[model samples]
Target: MTGTIENMIVKLTGWLSRHSIDVLRVSLGLVFVAFGTLKYFPGVSPAEALSVATLEKLSLGTVSGYAAQFVIASMEVFIGLTLVTGKLLKTGLVVMTGAMAGFFAPYVLFFTDLFPGAPTLEAQYIFKDIVLAAAAMVIGARALGARLIPAYERQAPVHEIRERVAA
Candidate 1:
């Protein structure tokens, strides 16, 4: 019984470890494609107003309205296609990182409105960019054959964790 359980656990971990990156990539791709498609139909996307407002504020009101939304939608679609197809993945991650940065920038610019006691609707919508950015980082690192964990964390030994736990 013990051996069977151990084998099953090991297989599960192996399967998950192997497929985790693909799962992240595909899910992110799906989200981007769905949201981007929604932007094409006016009044379909909940973020339309927030997007326009953020761009307007970012560009001092010069870059707002339908044009900005169209550009963002195009970008998202391109990123999604590239990600889903696993073609030009690095490029996709780069574009995704940039877009996420822009999406979240207004949070900082309008800190009081966004981060008071509770986040407003727009703030709540854009806050998910943090997770998207982190996911992009993970995918980017995998694309570049690099470690997702920082060098400091990588350098720490298993013994250190055991010692800390013992303490």
Candidate 2:
């Protein structure tokens, strides 16, 4: 029984080892970039989607809304591109994770309570943010070298196999 469990565990580890973080990076990157684009540009579609009158009455439609959207967009794009490229992968992940956390605060506090039908909306957003942040943490670990092995790795061989020269 113990042997069987050991074998199973080994198989599981092997399977996990075979997989790379690249897939996760791609997925997360695409999501961030696309969402950022929508938030940033917001153009006609978003304007239509929003409660224009309510937004206008709140003074959110004029300046703050557009400015906030741009900031959100810029961050998203930066994070997404960095994630995809694995550029300063660890550092970027940490920074982006922080930004995402900041972005999550308002939804959890102000917006969540405003919804009559779903007073828990902000909580849900916070939960999702937590999950995303966890993912980012995982990605960041690889960059910081605390993890046993980095995800989505393209590692060099352990030793140089020099060819023997004939006399």
Candidate 3:
């Protein structure tokens, strides 16, 4: 029974490893596209105020209000489309990473208000970008020919191992 369970787990892990990248890309793309589109319509997006404020602060008051919100939303849509279509994926990943950094800034820059003691709902939502950004990095790295795992199993040579053991 234990052997059977282990076999099943291995098979499941293999399947997930094969498909996880596409899943990550598509799901993240959908989220970005949806949220970006929401920003275009006034009073539709819950994040407008917070996003605008963050942009304003980051821009030193030179950028603020609806204009900043719209600009950010447009960028999100562009990144989403690129990621979804697998067109210029590297660019999308780079942009998304930067955006995620900006997205996460409020928690640090406005800690007193955003966190106080525990995190606010808005902060919680923004925090999810950390995971998403990491996922994007994985996808991007793989797309650029990263070797996350060796294609074949590897073990140290017997003599090398013996020497180390002896030492």
Candidate with top TM-score is 1
- Model 2, residue 124: what's the lDDT? 51
**What stretches of model 2 exceed 4 Å from their correct place?**
1-12, 43-63, 111-117, 120-126, 148-167
Q: For residue 109, give model 1's deviation from the true position in Å.
A: 2.7
Query: What is candidate 2's lDDT per residue for 1-167, written digit by digit as tens?
Result: 87566555545544565455566676777767776677655563242223223333344546355655565567777888888887767666866866765655454345635465764544454456576777777667656764444221334232311111110
Q: What TM value does model 1 have?
A: 0.79
Best-performing candidate as measured by lDDT:
3
RMSD vs true structure, all candidates: 7.1, 8.5, 6.9
Cα lDDT tens digits for candidate 1, 115-151: 7888888788887877877877777888888633423
How many clashing residue pairs, candidate 1? 0
Which one wins by TM-score: 1 or 3?
Answer: 1
Compute each candidate's TM-score over C-alphas: 0.79, 0.60, 0.78
Query: What is the lDDT for 19 in model 3?
Result: 75
Off by over 4 Å in 1: 60-62, 115-117, 147-167
Worst ten in a row by lDDT for model 3: 147-156
